[model samples]
Target: MAQQLILVTGAARCGKSEWAESLAIASDRAVTYIATATVDPADPEWQARIDRHQQRRPATWQTMATVEDLAQQIEGAEPTQCLLIDSLGTWVANLLDRSDVEWEKIAQALLAVLPTSRGTIIMVAEETGWGVVPAYPSGRLFRDRLGMLTRQIGSISSTVYLVTGGHVLNLSQLGQKLDR
Candidate 1:
């Protein structure tokens, strides 16, 4: 199969992770789940969510958890494998403390390297632009950053799926018919 770079995005609890996982499994390759969420061993709720994810995947699939160096991880995957980066929002949250310039540098670096990944890549990201403007500064910052990053990744993705209520809509398949 040809190398596929897919971006699966939707609102929270919309099954983006499950969709990405299924896609990776269907690829018929050795799947490597690149988890971007930072795990806190003491938090039972966080541990429960992690446990759910762990129990859902096949035994043959491998998982790598990291808060940074995502591009390098994708680059390191074998050509015969499939790499699934579940949720870009948490990844951005992990780097929110950096100055605007620093964050730009990091985001640009990941964007630059993503297209060069050797294996099939499926990335899960949250679509938060439709919601109300965040009341706090950090919330607003996160919303804006995730929106910008999603657009950048979508531009490079071979396919972009907008998942809503467990249904996925292929944005590209809609066709670019402008109402001008």
Candidate 2:
């Protein structure tokens, strides 16, 4: 089977994570859920959300949680295992302290490594641009940075899905259909 880089993007709470999980489950290879979310024991709501995500995943699937070394983790995985990265937004959020240049460097590294990655890769990202503009500068910065990262990843991805209100749009096909 052909390996694919699939990008699933949508607004918050639009079932993007569930969709990515479904795709990973459908893959023939072993699925490794590369979790980027940081758990805070002090926050009950955050803990509950994390618990919900954990419950949705299959028991057999391996999970690695790390904000950094994403590339290294992906590269070290077995060639036969599919890697499902749940949310790029969180990963980017974790690195907010880095300068734009530093963030860009990381993104560039990811873009370079992903094309050569062994197994089918699925990534989830939030489409935050559709909402109202952020009131604060940092929020705007995060939104803009995530947007740029999404475009870069989507451009390299074999297929891109835009999920909204329980619907999914095949962006690659849509682009072609519209061009014609």
Q: TM-score of each candidate?
A: 0.94, 0.94
Tell me the deviation in Å of residue 122 in model 1. Answer: 0.2
Summarize candidate 2's per-residue lDDT along 1-180 as a digit string, tens digits: 368899999999999999999888888789999999999989999999999999999999999897967777777656788899988999989988899898888878888888888888999999887788999988998999899888888888898999999998889888742221
Clashes of each: 0, 0
The residue pairs that clash in candidate 2, if any, are: none
- Could you tell me the TM-score of candidate 2? 0.94
For model 1, what is the C-alpha lDDT against the true structure? 0.88
lDDT of 1 by residue, 99-176 (tens): 999999989889987888789999999998696899999999999999989988888888888899879888878745
Model 1, 82: alpha-carbon shift in Å? 0.5
